[model samples]
Target chain A: MDVDRLHRRRRRWKERLMTVLIYLSVLVALLPLFSILIYVAIKGIGALNWDFFVRLPGPVGDPHAGMANAIVGTLELLLVAAAVGLPIGILAGIYLAEFGGHGLFSNSVRFLADVLSGVPSIVIGIFAYALMVLPVKHFSGWSGGVALGIMMIPVVTRTTEELIRMVPRSLREAGLALGVPRWRVTVSIVLRTAAGGLTTGAMLALARVAGETAPLLFTAFGNRYWHRSLNEPVAALTLQIYQYAISAFEDWQRQAWGAAFVLIIMVLILNILARLGTRSKFSTQQE
Target chain B: MSSSATGIPGQGHHPPAGRTGSGGTGEQPGGPLAAGGLQFSSRPRRGLADALFKAVTGAFASLILVLVLLLVLELVRSSWPSLKAFGWRFLVTQTWDPVRQQFGALPFIFGTVVSSLLALILSVPVSLGIAIYLAEMAPHWLRGPVSFLVELLAAIPSVIYGLWGIFVLVPLVRQLEVFLGTYLGFIPLFSGPPYGIGMLAAGIILAIMITPTIAAVSRDVILAVPNSQREASLALGATRWETIRNVVLEYAQSGIIGAIILGLGRALGETMAVTMVIGNRPEISASLFSFATSLTSVIANEFNESGGALHISALVELGLVLFLVTIVLNSLARFLVWQVQQRNGGAARV
Candidate 1:
């Protein structure tokens, strides 16, 4: 009886010890994320000013430099990428949801999309350089846009397909009963129902691509001056931050922090918006 | 009139045929009923429209396959010149002199493998702990917010991690190296000078970057473990910790391995953060504090400024190597995930 009691006591102590270790591990895992966010805010908040959004970057040693051109250039590149990738992604998704019949062709397409999404972004940059920059004899915003577009395709396609598949088959039957063509039923009814989710997916993809610096390092090539044409080299916020962080200039380093702050805020906002969209959709379905 | 009468009964009894015929005459092309199906005189136009839409969407779907093939072909073609010149020496040679135009992949590959494996070793325990906490221990109200925060770490860009690493992580690593070197100085792995920006710093940053991926996936896998297993263990007088350690973890072993493999893929392909903190020197060393360069980092650093054809081709070859490593890792991860799903009766969502 004495030995059994001692064994039970030791077992309880070990269990308590393991439980404490688990909680401590949680704290350790979360510490770096909170520290990084807090540090960036502390260092970056001081550099934000009206001029930071209005004026162009000054020379290397200038203390009042801003990244206005890079901000505009980033938006332009995103717009071009959206225009090129969105249509193809949505249409392909439509094919998968409506016309796909569990055949070898659709299966291969799905597999390829999965594979493409996993490819490293830097490799995609090299691909864009080989395909577009070599042919044109220069790095251009268009090449950067193409690289970003390729990255966006798989995310957009997967999300769109999932959302379209979520639309109830009963709705399609109702449209078909009313004598609507199959394609018409898909476009007018199914797509209309899935628009909100599709938009959320697109926003998430855009947010991801906006912060990509590796692809832009080679494709856009980071011009110092204001760029107006798609065929010309352009600066991007992420690329600018990379350049500033690596340079020896103290002022540039400070600006890099400021750019990092802005980029993080934009990405977080998009993520929050997507979360809200998904929540509302779920609640409505439950109701 | 005749077509309308047939359509009304056909819609009720044979919905599939009725729907097909009503959409267009393409379904009954050259059939005996073609003359009657042609009552809708715009059938030809509708048929053309349907065919056009299918063709367009199918073309777009096939484009993804073409793109993957093109990526592989282009990388091979671009790296051909170097492959022809170096034959097999490129993989074994260690010199990376751009002035002398000698390039080798051994050092970079060594750095990438060592750093990524070190990161996996450091991160797996903490990640598994977080996963278990979220899946089994956390209360209902705490699970949602904590999981969201963990996933938010993943949404943060790699470049932001790079920026944070440069200013915040490098200094702390320098201090840690001093303490380690004092105590473990006799050991070869701790014998080198501490540059602060070296394999150790890169590995730490990679551990942080990949922790969320492993935790999230592992949490899902643990949750997929049937509740009856836990209840049975408890009923048998097993402690909560014992039940989890023996039953839940054993059941989710394959899934946990899959999550680790997925994290490994991310660490190996990581470019920006690793490049920023890794000190970007081409060398194979035993010391964790020695500066090292990875495959992705080398390509990112040199591809643009390379002047000669051979130099550019060599960089492309490095890319090919990274690409092949990641593809193999990802495929293995997918297969393991599929195995987990199969074991779970196809209910595992991730």
Candidate 2:
């Protein structure tokens, strides 16, 4: 009995030690994130102003000038990307989950999609640059959206497929039993049951593309003035931050922090929304 | 936003089908058997409209696949100009002087493989420990928050990581380099110029960046092991640690290795962070503290400024190399996961 007691105590001690190490690991993970956030928030608070939101980025050295153009450009590109990519992504998701099975073509498509998921965003940018920017003789925000749309598709498709697959097959069969066509059963039954998940996935993908800088560096090529043209070079918060942060100027560097803060905040909000979207419906279903 | 809301409502305005369908009679189309012939009859489709809808849906699905194929093809074609010009020598030669239109990728390739391997070597043990803690030892209440924080690390953009590495981690690494040189200078790896931004620093930052991917996937794999194995080990009078060491880790070994490979792939493709911390030196080095340039970092830093035929081709070649590395890593990971699934299936059969 005493030996068992000692063994139990030893196990408890080991467990406790492991728990402490786990917490410490979590703390270490938070260190970089917290440091960056705190630094950005502290430096950026002073620059937060309405003028900063409405004016163009100043010359390479200036910090007081606003990031209006970047702000507008990011939103425009994200909107355009969603417009182009979402329906296609969701539909592909539908096909993969609902229509796809053991067919050779479907398997090939699935393999290609997985490969696309692993390809770096910068390569996607390079491809867009070679295909669109080079041929068009100039950079354009449309191509930026195109690059982002490409990145978003695999992510959206994967999530959408997973969610749609979670819907019961009986529902699909019931729709078909009502003399509804296969397409109708897919559209109305499977997709509707999976709507919450699809939305969450699409939003997460949008959030991801919104923060992308690599593709934009080559595709949209950064704008300083608000031209409101997708054909023209457009300044985005990420690109602005990238270009400014790299320059040998402190004032511009401070503004980069400001932009980082803004981008981080935007990502945070989108994440919260995505979490909420995924969680609320998911929990109800679990119950 | 409103237009999107309107457009999406059209997609979403369907009946609650899945849950309700399950409750319905097995033979009936829907519950309560509105079995009148009129109820069972199909409404005549507005034939052309229905046809158009089907075509549109099919087109949309095909478009994503088409886009993916086009991307791969475009990469191949764009890479060809340089691959053909340089031949296999592109991977061997290290001279990257663009002024003379001479370019090579040996340094970049070396840096990428070395730094990525270093990251994997450094991170795998620490992350495995963390995963074991989370999967086996953590209180249920602490698990979700810890997992969420790890996931949030992934959400932090690579650029933010770059900035933090420059402003915060680099100085710390520089201090540590001085200390390491003081104590370990006899070792060739520690006998370098004490520039903080070197291969070692980049590797360490990458280790930190890739840890979450390793830890998260590993935790999931460990948790998937059946409780029966644990009980069986306990029944043999084994300690908990023994049970975990002999049973849990054994079951999760393949998946854990897969997770590490996934993390390695992320480290390999990491661009902005390595760019900011790697000193941008396009030189091959044997010492860990020497400055170097990774393939992705070189492309990210120099691609825009790289004018002329050879310069551009060289950068594209680096991208191709990174792409191939990631493809192999992902395939390895997928294969491992498949094996784990198969093992679990075979166990069930036994």
Candidate 3:
């Protein structure tokens, strides 16, 4: 009895210690998250002004600098990326959902999408550089957008497949019973049912690509002034932040933080909204 | 919604290629229509439209495969010059001087492996702990916001992490490096001038960047472990921790490993943060404080300003290497996680 009591006491102590360690790990894991947010907010919030959002970046040591062109350029690049990525991804997803049935081809495509998602963004940058920029002999927004588009494809494809697959089989059956064509059933019934999920997925992919810096490094090849066309080098939020952060100028460093602040806010907002969107979706499904 | 339920289309099963290939012609003309076979004799026009739709969608799906093939082809084609110039010497040589055209990938490979492995080591236990906490230990109220916060961490851009790594993480790391160097002077890994922007910084920043991925995947994996496993252990009079260690974790083992491997794949490909804080010098060093470079960083930093054809080729070769390695790692990780999910009869969320 005495020995058992002692053993139990020791085990209790060990368990308590382990529990403490486990809780501490959460803190440790979240430390960087809180640190980045706190540091950026503290450093960046004070630097924000109307010019920071609207006006063009000023020369070195100029406090009147802004990142309007980068902000606009990022939006433009995203549009091009969406135009390129969404259709192919969503259509491929429909293939997997409507026609694919654990067949070898769809399985291979699924595996390829997963692997493609894992390919480093830098490699895609190189791919873009070789495929588009090298042939044109100039870095342009189009190259950057294509790189981002390629990156988005796997994410969007996977999510779109999953969402379309989520639509009840009975719905398709119901559509077919109405003498509708298979394509009409898929588009009108299946696709419509999953549209919300598709939106959320697309938003998530966009949010992810929005923060990507590596792919744009050589592709967009950031310009200092306003960019005019998809054919020309474009300023981007990430590239600008990178340029300023690495510069010797202290003011530029500050502006980098300001730009990062805007970037972070955009990314976080999209992420949160998407998560909420999925949550509501799950709740409805559960109901 | 569970994927397995809806993953199948029309419940035809994995119909063989032959059956599916001639499915349209086999149903043609409704030869001697039986009770249930083809009462309406499906219209040929509708069949054509369906075939066209399938063709279009299948063609688009094949484009993904085509895109990957194109990626491999482009990489190999562009890097052929470097391959011819370097032969096999590129992998073993350490010098990366482009001016003299001496390109060796040894240093970058070393940095990438060392830093990514270091990140895995630093992050796994913490990520597993968070996974266990969120999946099994946290009160319901705490789970929602904590998970959202973790996802928010994942949302922060890597460039911003690089920015943070530069201004915030480096200065703080300098103090740690200085302290470690002063105290652990005998250990080669810790013995060097503390630059605060070397392998150690890269590893730490990578650790921070990959934590969310590992944690989120792990949480999903642990949750996927059936409740019956835990209940059985509890019924056997095991302590909660004991049940977790012996049963829950054991069941979730492959999944957690998959999560870590996935994180590893992410770390290897990470460029912006690693590039900014890794000091960007190609060197193989035992000391964590010494400058180093990684594969992605070298590519990201030098691709644009490449000196000439050979230089660009070398970078593309490095990219090819990265692309292939990540694909292999991802496939392996997904296979492992898929195995666990198969066993537990639950879908693993990525």
Candidate 4:
């Protein structure tokens, strides 16, 4: 009886100990995030002024400089990425969700989507360079956009497919019951029904690629001033942050902090917006 | 974020082939699959719109397949020069002298593999812990917010982690390295000049960056184990820990391994964060405190400024290697996870 009691007590103690350890692990997992957030914010507070947003990035230690061109470039690049990525991603998703045959072919598409998402962004840079830049023999914003676009395809495809699949099969039946053409039903009823969720998912993918730097390193190939055309090299917020972080100047490093902080805010805002959108009635509805 | 939301009913809830494909073959008119009477409804005439829609969407789907195939072809073509020049020597050779135009990837490969494995070792336990806490222990109200925050860590840009690593993590790592070197100097892994930005820092950052992928995936897998098993264990007089250790962990083991391999793929492919703090040396070392450079980092640092054709070719070859490695890892991970979920009676929820 005493042994049984002792054994039970020991087991309870072991359970208590492991529980504490697990709690600590949570603390460890979250520590870096909070640290990065707080540290970058604290370091970047000084650079959040209007001039920091308005002026061009100056020579190494210059105080009156900003990432104006980079900010614009990032937006421009995103626009290009959206143009290249959205149509193909959404259309491909429609194929998978609406028309894909349940066989080896559709399975491979979905499988490849996972594989592509796991592909390093750097390889995409190489791909862009080889496909677009090598023939042109120069770096350009278009290549960077292409790289980010390829990266976006899988995420956008999966999300769109998922959201569209959630649209009630009964809804589809009703549309067909009205003798609506299948394409019309898909475009008007099904796509429209899931539009909010699709938009959020796209936003999440955009948020992810917006901070990409490696692919742009060789493809977009950072520019100092405003780019004249899609053919020219473009600056990206992420590339600028990378360049500045590694530079010898402390002032440039400070700007790196500011840039990192801005990038984080952009990503976090997209994430928050996506979550809110995910909570929209259509998505939160019972499957 | 969709995957991160995880338990949100419709988010990632659909299997790719679960309810899809009315067989899509336009030849089947008003047959078995046409019962829904959607596109294949009996009609007086065959319609162009339906054919066109199917054609266009099919074309787009086929394009995805073609795109990946083309990407591989492009990589092979671009890396051909280096492949021809280096032959099989490229994999095992150590020297990467750019001036004389000799390049070998042994060091970068070693660094990438070692640092990633180090991250896996350090992170899997912490990740599993977080997964267990959230899936089995945490109050229902807390799961949503905590899971979101952890996944947000994954979403934060790699460059942001690089920046933080440079200024924050490197310094802290230096202190730890020096302490370890001071007392545990006898061990090869701990003995070296305590350069702040090196293998250990890279591993630590990778571990932190990778924790979310594992934690979230494992949490989902564990949550899917069905509560009845837990009830049975509890009814059998097992302690909560015993139930979790013997049953929950057992049931979710393969899925957890898949999650870890997925994290491994991400670690192997990660570029920017490692680039910022890995000290950018090209030498293999037993000491984790030594400077190192990963395959992706070497490509990032040198691709734009590569000296000549061979140099660029070499870097592209390195990228090709990285790509193939990640593809293999991710494919393996997906297969394992799929196997378990298939047995579990459905596709996994993300």
Candidate 5:
């Protein structure tokens, strides 16, 4: 009886110990994230100024240089990528969700999308280089946009498909019963309903590709000066950060932190907005 | 409603039969010959439109498949020159001199594997602990916020991680290495002089980068374990920890393995973070404190300055290697996750 009592006490102690360990583990897991964010904020805030947003980068040793060209170039690349990727991704998603008949073809498309998403971003850069840069014999904003666009496709397609699939089958059936063409029903009824979720998905994908530096390295081939055409090499936030961080100069390193701060802020805002969008839409649907 | 009058047979359009029959036979039989002629012409056009829509959407859907195939084919084609030049020796030889036009993939491959595995080893325990805490232990109110914070880790860009690694992690790791070297210097792995930026820093940063993925997936997997399993174990006189160890983790082992593999895939292909801290030395070393280079990092570091066809081809070949490794790992992860879902009798709600 005494031994049984002792064993019970030991087991209880062990369980309590394990519980403490679990909580500590959570702290340990989250330590890096909080540390990085706080440290970056501290370092980055010191470098920000009005000129940081407006003035172009000066020469290597020049002080008070800003990444204005890179900021504009990043937006242009994102614009082109969105224009190219969104329609294709949404249409393909529509096919998978609406017209897909659970056949081998649709299955293959889904599988390939997953595979493509898993492919290294640098590999996509290489692909863009071979496909676009090789043909044109130049690394241009177009190639960078195409590389990022390809990276965006799988995420956008899968998210759009999942969101569309979540729309009740009854909605589709009702449209069909109304004597509407299937395509018309999909476009007017189904897609309209899923637009909020689709937009959230696209924003998430955009957030992801915005920070991709490896792909743009070979494709955009970063320019120091402001580029005005898609045919010209483009400056990008990630590329600028990478270049500045790697350079020996302390000022460039500080600018790299500034760029990182901007990039992270943009990404976190997009992520939060997407989550809020999804939450509100889902809550409304539940109601 | 009158539009049902033009319903064509065998076109898969399910216009209501009552409306179609009444409208077509009774009303439109001999009334308004022009209207009847217009309806007849529009039927074929509507059928054509349906076919056309299906064909176009199907074509767009197939583009993903086409793109994947094209990627593989293009990588193979571009790397063919290097593949043909070095043949099998390209993968085994350690030399990589652009001046001598000698190239090999062994060192980079070794570095990639070692660093990724090191990350996996360091991260899996913490991730599992967090997963268990979130899935089985955390109270309802805490679960949502904690998981959100974890996921935010994933949302941060890789380059940002690299930036942090350079300024923050590398210095800390350098100090840690000094302490380890003093205490564990007899071990070959801890013998080298700590450079502050090497395989160890790269691996630690990678661990931080991939922790979210593994933790999130493992949490989902653990949550998917039925409540009955826990109840049964508790009823059998098992402690809570025992139940989690023997019942929860045992059941979700495959999924956790899958999560680890997925994280491994991410680590292997990680470019910016690893490159920023890895010191970019293209040599194999016995100590974790020594500099190393990965396949993706080498390509990113060199593709811009690569002068000739041979140099570019060699870099492409490295990419091909990284591509193949990630693809295999990712496919395996997918299969494992699918198996877990099948075992759960539905999606895991992740």
Candidate 6:
């Protein structure tokens, strides 16, 4: 009886120790994120006043200045990237999930996708710079968008493929049995079933591309004024944050925090939307 | 929303055809609707569309692969002139003058390797410990939230990390550097005055950034270990710790190690953050606290600033080196994961 009690006590103690360790681990992992967020938010809030939002980044001692060019530039670049990348990514994904057979060609394409997914964004920027800018003798929004789009394609394609594959084969079989064309079956049954997931994937890809700085540094370079031309150098939130944070000026430093805050918030919102889209799809499937 | 509910023009599922494609072949053995069917009737059109789809998808995938190949080719092409001029001296020489169009990559290479090695050293053990704790000790309720938070760490942009490192981490490191230099000045690595924004600081920041990836992947692998193994170990008079150390960890070791290697890859490719905190100076040094420039950081710092053919080529060469390092790391990680999977399958067969 005494031995049994002793063993039970030891087991309980071990379990308690495990619980403490778990909490400690969680704390260590979470602290950096919390610190980053809190710091950005606190410092950034003071900088987001009325004039700061309306004005462009100007001369030294200009307290009224804001990242107006950056805000517009990021939107334009992202939109262009989506326009170029989304269709290609979605189509590729459709082909892979629906039409792919066990062949050398299919295997090679899969290998390519994996390799593309792993390649760093900086290299993509370099490639774009060499291809576009060297010939043009200019940094432009188009170059940046192209590079970002290249990075986006692999992610979107991979995610879309997985989501499409998640759609049951039975749906396609049923359509085929009803004399539906293979294309029709894929379009109607497989794609419709996976629409929510595809959207989430696209959004996630967007979130990823938005945070990139290295690619934009080379491709878009940087703009000081609000410019609408795709041929002109464009600023982005991440790039602005990079410039401001690294510059010697104190006001620029403050602006960097504000930009970082905005970027983080935007990303978090996109992430939440993606999660919601995924959850709804999951629940609908269950129903 | 309404369109989504009903699906678009071609998206609705037709009723089941009551027949299953089970027996001998995909084709029906009967004559009436056997040979080709409606899909076959539009075979030419379908064929065209299929070809178009294949072409587009093939191009998309191929473009990505080509980009990687092109990067290597372009790097080689650009660096050829410099390679011809410098011969074997480029890797050894430490000079980087743009006015005279002279350059070398030894310092950048040294800085990159040292910083990455330092990051790996610091991150691996802490990450594994976190993984073990999360996989073995965390309550069910806490697990998801903790994992989510760790993933969120990955979502924060590298620039934010750089900003934090500049404003927060460097100052803290400076205090430590002073104390260490005061106490351990006899050591060559600690002999120099700590500028704080250097290799050591960059490595520490990188370790923090990569810890989440390693921990998350390691936790997944550790959690994948079958409960039966743990139960058997416990049944054989092993404690929970002993069961984890002897049975569960041993089973998941390959995967955990692969996860660490993956994190190492991330550390190697890390750009903006490392660039910001690494105190961009182009010189080889044994001291971690001294200002140094890495391959990626050097390119980033000087690609725009460094004019002329040879300088650009040298920078591209540096990128090539980085690209190769990652490719090797990724392939190795994939192989390790595959080996682990094969081992698990073999155990199952047993």
The candidate that wins on TM-score is: 4
Fnat, model 3, is 0.65
Model 2 lDDT per residue over B1-350, tens place: 00111011111112233223222112223554435543345444533444555456557777767876777677777778888878889899989888987778889889988998999888887788777777887788887776767666777777777777777788898999999999998898888878888898899889888887788777766776777888999899776677778899998889788878878878888887788789889888777888999888878877777787678877887788878878898778756745664565422211
TM-score of chain A of each: 0.96, 0.91, 0.97, 0.97, 0.97, 0.93
Comparing 2 and 3 on lDDT, the stronger one:
3
TM-score (C-alpha) between model 3 and the true structure:
0.94
Which is better, 2 or 5, measured by lDDT?
5
What CA RMSD would you report for each candidate?
7.7, 5.9, 4.0, 2.6, 7.8, 6.1
Candidate 1 error regions (>4 Å): B1-47, B348-350
DockQ-derived CAPRI band for the predicted complex in model 2:
acceptable
Tens-digit lDDT string for candidate 6 (A35-143): 8989989988877877666779977678788888888888888898888678777887666655553356555665566556566667777778887898999999999
lDDT per residue for candidate 1 within B41-158, as digits (tens), equals 5455766777788789889999998999999999999999989988789988998887887888899999899999989998999999999999899998998788878777777888
Taken over the whole model, the C-alpha lDDT of each candidate is 0.81, 0.75, 0.83, 0.84, 0.83, 0.75
Residue range A33-133, candidate 4, lDDT tens digits: 89988998899886677877888888876778899889888988998999888888899888888877456877788777777788898999898899899
Which tens-of-lDDT digit does each residue in B154-229 have in candidate 5?
A: 8888888888898888899999999999999899999899888999999999898888878887787787788888
> Which pairs clash inside model 6?
A188-B11
Interface RMSD of each: 9.9, 6.6, 5.0, 3.0, 9.9, 7.2
Tell me the tens digit of each residue's lDDT in model 4 across B1-350.
22632211122335543565455444332323355545446464435676788789878777789889998998888889999999999999999998998989999999999999999999999999999999889998998889988988888899999999998999999999989999999999999899899999999999998998889878877876767778999999998999999998998888789889988998999999999999999999999999999999999998878899899889989988988988898878766665565566654332
Residue B256 error, candidate 6, Å: 1.6
lDDT per residue for candidate 6 within B84-202, as digits (tens), equals 88777887888988778777878888888788889989878777767777678767787667666777787788989999899988998888889889999789887699788898899
TM-score of candidate 5 versus the correct structure, residues matched by position: 0.92
Candidate 1 has an fnat equal to 0.55
TM-score of each: 0.92, 0.88, 0.94, 0.95, 0.92, 0.89
True-structure Cα RMSD, model 3: 4.0
* C-alpha DockQ for predicted model 6: 0.41
Q: Where does candidate 5 clash, by residue pair? A: none
